[model samples]
Target: MPTALTAAYILHTLFAGVWVGAVLLATWKVVPLAKGGDLGPDALRSIESGLTTLTRLAAVVFVATGGHMAATVYGSEGLFGTGRGHLVLTMLTLWFVMTALVEVGGRRMRSALDVGKVRTAARDADAFLKAASVAGLVLLVIGGYLAGPAV
Candidate 1:
């Protein structure tokens, strides 16, 4: 049977992949399409809807799996036990904050988009998405370190 830590690692990796993959798709494909005028109003609306759906889904997975991983790895001692635990805690906290920001900012952007305020919504949404991407990358690095062979 897999150890708790092993299970946690697997769950964390899965959520991290989802988060990172979504961010990459948005940045490398979606944004460029929007910029090149290939994504007009209807297209933008559709994209925004898709983004909102995916982000929310990913955030749910992130939070649930993250909490489970933390509990499994750290137990009641929490994250103060070791260097690796500390790194994981930090990354998790950052992910939570960034996810909250994205939720709020994305909602605002959607509202703005609904009112035909394309430019403003696009700007804010882009900023939120970028922040999310950065946070996701940081978490990925920290998670990789944690999963690496212990020093």
Candidate 2:
């Protein structure tokens, strides 16, 4: 059980980091480049495709590992009755927000790209991507706080 819990934590943290990093990069670098005409539509589409894949993969991993850890650490009681539990709940909410943002942003970008509208796609997706980036950072901070020695 200990080993399994450890593994779960490792996976959860790693996937979260990867997701957040990708969002940050896309929000800060990719979108700007695309908007500025520095990045071609083909390249932007490729990046968006890769980001979508990573986002979906990370979301699945996060849910599985997070559920296991929550079940193990808090049992049923730890869900809503404690401070850590609140943080976990918050993280879960942010996770959903990030996932939705990615989905919507990807859809917007893909549709525009499909029509050969590169700048329009970038403009449409930028806000959602930026919001997701902020949410991802907050999730990481809360996760770190929850992982303190008290746990």
lDDT of each: 0.72, 0.92
Q: What's the TM-score of each model vs. the native? A: 0.80, 0.96
Shift in Å, residue 150, candidate 2: 2.0
In model 2, the clashing pairs are none
| Residue range with the least summed lDDT across 10 consecutive positions in model 1 | 31-40
Candidate maximizing TM-score: 2
- Compared with the true structure, what per-residue lDDT tens digits does model 1 show for residues 27-137? 567766665656666777776677667768877776777778777767656577887778877986987876776676568667877787666666667777777778878
The model with the greatest lDDT is: 2
Backbone clash pairs for candidate 1 read none
Per-residue error for 41 in candidate 2, Å, reads 1.1
Across 1-151, the per-residue lDDT of candidate 2 in tens digits comes to 5698999999999999988999999999999999998899999999999999999899789879999999999876788888888888989999999999988999999999999998899999999999999999999999888888775
Indicate the residue-level lDDT of 92 in model 2: 91
